[model samples]
Target chain A: MIRAQKIGKSFGPLRALSDVNFEISQGELIALLGANGAGKTTLIRILAALTRPSTGTAEVAGYELNREQQQVRKRIGVVSHQTLLYGEMSAQENLYFYGRMFRVPDLQSRIDELLGLMELKKRRHDLVRTFSRGMQQRLSLARAVLHQPNVLLLDEPFTGLDIHAEELLTRFIEKAVADQVTVLMTVHDLDYARDHAQRLLVLHKGRLAIDAAAAQTTRAQIVELIRE
Target chain B: MNSLQQIYTILHKDILLELRSKDIITTMLIFSLTVVVIFNFVFEPGSEEMATSAPGILWVAFAFASNLGLSRSFAREQENSNMQGLLLCPVDRSAVFTAKVAGNVLFIFLVELITLPVMVLFFDLHIGPVWLPLLGTLILGTLGFATVGTVFSAISANTRSREVMLPIMLFPVTVPIILAAIKSTSYLLAGRDMSQVWSWLRLLIAFDVIYFVVCFLLYEYVVEE
Candidate 1:
């Protein structure tokens, strides 16, 4: 579960997020849609415990964002545009490193399974810098879900994903949601968000402008909301 | 995972990455050696001035080289925003700080270990019975440098001109460490009695402990976004 109450964040004169409020029940897959500088990533970063909100408070997986950050972090998996991986280390090594940090059980098998799914098992030993953008994104995705986190926050996770990788991600999200893993992702692709997520959240100029069910709202409505 | 395990996992990862890439250690070794060689030429080898200046020269090399190493260590984390990834883990923030300090200390110490013999050979310096004390001084000084450097590296790694920001933030805070290290090293190099060097050693220990504790407590805030 995830909850945000009157959250705001500011950097000097610029306000990145303001009075944002939203909540998602367990296993609900929500898509956060916003244009550049619309505070989508800021909200996700707050929920991920990577950044503190300048005002109000949030709870992720029953842990308070401000005071219980370590507990919150333990329950969530995050993937940003950046791979958050070591290029000098191999793909497998990177996963192993995170797995150890998160104390993932049966980590080697989990790594092997994810690497196989990402179509990177053959290149598992090669340094991450040697991998292509799409491959690295795939590895990043693999790293995110490696711990089987209770809450998954993905920020533009599809940035460099190819068509097949996108499909794989969709299926993975479907499976994760089915398994009762709460998911909130920032996505630019309105069509994919409409097709995949159970709910949609639209942010405009540091505020949450729309919160609606995807099945009830068409992509056109979502587009108009984003435009507004 | 436990706190110590988390620390080791991070330290091991850094060491593995360094071993594979040979980036930080090699660069540090080369840069420090360059400093040593340049100082050799500047002060003239085997002269009384060179003998007197050996400890200062050695630490200057060690200091600047460790500066580079600390900058690169955090810069590596910035590459993929791996620092964020590290912060996202379940461990205490101090674990990350401790791991980074450990890695930096190891790399800088390795650089110093190699540079010392070269300094001795080039400057015609004697270790005598103070070799152990000299070694102790080097370890303490390196610890002080790393404890402070690791914190500054994280702060500066977020800034635009991180390379410039690191030294500006680091050297001033580490002034006591450098002064103490240089004095203790000079005393040890001169074959002074341990009693003569004890005061500087105490100061070095005091600073190292103080910096380590303060940095450990403040690291969580420093790495915050």
Candidate 2:
């Protein structure tokens, strides 16, 4: 469902990603672990077709980056540190806007279901700005998966989520994986990544340093890889 | 959905947001009114200076109001990185540009609509038979303002000093539109026949077309990170 071949990115004299290569099969939940400048978000942005790579190539859901950006964008969902939601608008309006953007059929019902699933049905009409951080994150998740994307890219989704919101997000992600949706998430939470992800990919200095199954690698080794 | 549906969807969202927050429209209307009110005090209402300067004052107010509105509109999109969310959709980038332009035009036109009547009343001008041509001139000028303003707003939004950047970048490129609009409005306000305003109107139409096409083509690049 996702492939990258020697994907590289440079910001002037600084290199953000260097010859990074990875692939995730359908239904796989890969946790991308990295330090602050390790280029996880850059890679995610490249795969989402939002940023053009300075070198190499990437394909998501069988569509090549840049050349088939619209097609690629249609199949993927993204949630970053920012909620990507309008604070002035209601939760329902945000979902409706995205649904219409994606041209999702039966959008009203889909929005209702997602709102209910995210436990936002009661506050659907409330302005998003007035919501709590957790509530906003949940709504952001709902906005992300609103179109039923084939690929889900989450960048530090748990940054400010509370325990309950974190659990809710985990379960939702599990459900998405169960439905054969590929997910690539970047996180600073090592324990959660090891516990929830099927595989782990660590980036050190903008390079992929480790690619291993979660069960086969312990927490100590993962920590060592990140520090190294 | 098709491109038209996509455009309408975006435009609807913008309109809905504005209706709820009254952010862009309210700021623009108030600012434009303030400009007109101040200018009314500066120039005597029934004097010959007022007759010659009304068009310039009107468009200057409009230009400043547009700058405010465009900056606020794009800043709203940049909030929470909503512009990236918009870009992530399956629609063409040009559709997004078109919708934004439409939204800006509507907001600016609404400001113009409210402010125009106030200007006429404040200056004690007799528009009489020229009202229809004046309307046409306003729409053309607003369209051209929006067409150029939308693209530059997007560009400036990415910069650090966006508030200052929008006007700095927009005003230079929009000279032809403002010049033509002011000229056409002046002729109509002077009670001249349509024959005189026609050439300025034609220039406005040309600027609108050229800017729309060029901006439509360049938007895909401008918005890309």
Can you tell me which runs of candidate 2 are displaced by over 4 Å? A216-225
The TM-score values for the models, in the order shown, are 0.97, 0.96
Q: Which CAPRI level is candidate 1?
A: high
lDDT of 1 at B110: 93
lDDT of 2 at A93: 89
- In model 2, how large is the Cα lDDT of residue B144? 88
lDDT of 1 by residue, A59-117 (tens): 89998999999899889999888999999999999999999999999999999999998
After TM-score superposition, what is the CA distance of residue A53 in candidate 2 from its true location, in Å? 1.3
Model 1 lDDT per residue over B49-135, tens place? 998988888988999999999999999888889999998898889889989999999999998999889888888888867788899
- DockQ values for all predictions? 0.85, 0.82
- Sliding window of 10 residues with minimal summed lDDT for model 1 chain A: A219-228
Interface RMSD, per-candidate values to 1 decimal: 0.9, 0.8
lDDT of 1 at B215: 96
